[model samples]
Target: MNKWIRKSAVVLISVLTFGLITPTQLITNVNAENPSERDTVEGARLGSYGQEASYFNEAEVDKDKFIEDLVKQAEMQSYQKFGTRIKPVIENEFREIVMPNIEKALQEIANQFPTEDLLNLAITESPGKGQSEKIFNIKNNNTNTDVLRFHVRRDNPPQAGYWFNFHYHTYHDGFQSHHELGSIYWDKNTPPKWMS
Candidate 1:
């Protein structure tokens, strides 16, 4: 009975956290200052309440799989759009900017709970073997709006689509780390915010 109640409570809270509580109520309750829109629920986007935060119990677990995919996709998209010219710069950024921060995020999560080695596997697999050819097809929650970040070699770049996160969970996660050296399609149920 206790376990059942706990589970039920979790579900209820998840629903409540997502705007499932009530639109009129949500607008009145949640504030604009909130960040990183919940991704686990329907209509979840950054900076507001939605599904993602609902199901997410810090105690439940910490597997940043979604973030991992998004980061890889971001890197690949940059290279794809820029070709060889911009690859070096983007690749450099991947090492300098992407890698370190993701590592720190993983540390934070790990310190909080007993993750099943997801973060370690992520780093080892991604940028690990330098299987740099793998491409991740990351799309946004809304099909019409894809979170694609393209790095133009020298000049202008298109200003369209939601600035999506590189991976759904974190950079270089374990779930899809073993991606073969080819094309991989990632369908995002909830998208992350893009970094400018």
Candidate 2:
């Protein structure tokens, strides 16, 4: 039958393609039973590929959930060598810089995609209601690096405005903070350049 031949051909093509693909090249679903390193890390820190250019489509993303996760993660990252607290880094950055810029960016995305309510919601709910106070229990369980940014230019809109960076080194042994200004942006015109 024609259907049988078509199915056989499809299977052959799939098998061939699978053999050619590398482990890193294969995209992982975020909801998988054993999530990939990319899926486990926000923005896919280990790999050069970002969630912006995810091969697997995400129908919905909850911004509040993301923010909540970040807050809980902050707690676990509070203490490092000599029982020093890193709570200030999370609270200060979230309130003063990260949240505001994220809000502005969300507004821009909302304006661009009026019908895409989920996108707007994802941006809006990023700033949580309150701060976490349990500093002692804040463990260093996270293995994914996180980078937060603040707008440099207030006069202009969020999309094209200047920015500052606040990144945490979670992949290594201790929680290291790195502050620098990098040109990381969402280009509506061009597709994301994912790693090969």
Candidate 3:
């Protein structure tokens, strides 16, 4: 069996047994390693899978486990803030929708970058009072145009709700500032900028 297929099967079984996600909400056809539903010719033309992502291939990449860990952490965060029990429906939504978006973004990044270079990237987390961010430092020699961050946060004051975002940041040395490339919303309005 393929490595991704085997890992995905184990993750699914674990999630089902642990009640992290419902059986009806499971993503059946999506591979944990490559979550895209479409098989475009451009992907082939770009040498998507042929590239030697030796670092990523060196060890088994359990993407599903990463996603599941994030979900479990987020659920705890939500419960702490709202003092309300997280319902199965909410977990279902994250499992069926939010996770796939993140997975697809990672897949897009892999396509855009060399596997070995991406392997050198750094992962960091900043957890504050109301918001938390997970940052992937895409170390660039010339400029800091390679950072990817995902924010999971709740609004303050009047708006008391939760929102999640995945976006890229480009730092300008001249301006001593960073500019956002774009955002990936929960709604389907725009594809993730990380892919671009």
Candidate 4:
């Protein structure tokens, strides 16, 4: 089968199995190595953005997973339906509107998984063909602007098989000289210590 068709199959299976959205499949439709594989997904993400208002609401999973699923499904389905002849216009919508929403939402899901893998796929799979750049050094340069690559560093990953306290605690100390205070990524939004 062609690449787009294969991606479609993968998406169908994944969504049904996990009941979770997968935007990367849409991105892969564009990144199809065979060139022909990159047909469906690459084009439609841009094309379908504003067409169906109900598309975002079609699948509801409540608070934490809501934004993640919405972004994933909307982009995936849209990209899957785009045509090569009209893909340019479709890709444009992804760059301007679709991606930013995804970015903001992902930030809120900063559980424990590093943001890099997820963002990387978004950029690689996006229609922009690598328009978004990576903030970290993990190298997987697939060209798709809609997909963005970023990283998250937590003290531990789940299933460590053991428990310990004060292992990954971070805190703010008293003020120091101009050069003493280093730039920390976690604040109230993330907090000093990595808890999750």
The model with the greatest TM-score is 3
- What local distance difference test score does each model get? 0.35, 0.32, 0.39, 0.34
Instruction: Show where candidate 4 strays beyond 4 Å.
Output: 1-62, 98-196
- Candidate 4, residue 119: the lDDT equals 28
Q: Write the per-residue lDDT of candidate 4 for residues 19-78, one digit (tens) a residue.
A: 334556545544665655345444443422223222333232133443454456545533
TM-scores, each model vs. reference: 0.24, 0.22, 0.34, 0.20
Tell me how many clashing residue pairs each candidate has. 24, 3, 0, 27
Better of 3 and 4 by TM-score: 3
List RMSD in Å for every model shown: 17.8, 18.8, 13.7, 18.6
Question: Which candidate, 2 or 4, would have the higher TM-score against the true structure?
Answer: 2
Error of 4 at 53 (Å): 23
- lDDT string for model 1 (1-196, tens) is 8657655655666587774455443443343344444422324422111124444344533355435443454444444533453344345645565455544543454444344322222211122112232233222332323222121111112543222223323224434333111211112232221221
* Count: clashes, candidate 2: 3
Query: RMSD in angstroms, candidate 2?
Result: 18.8
Error of 1 at 68 (Å): 0.7
Candidate 3 residue-wise lDDT, 1-196, digit = tens? 6767756775777676785443433443233356454543333322212221232452433444333433344434433332223223244565565556655554554455554344333333222332334333333333434444444332222333333433333333432343332332233232122111
Reference-based lDDT, residue 58, model 1? 42
**TM-score between candidate 4 and the true structure:** 0.20
lDDT of 4: 0.34
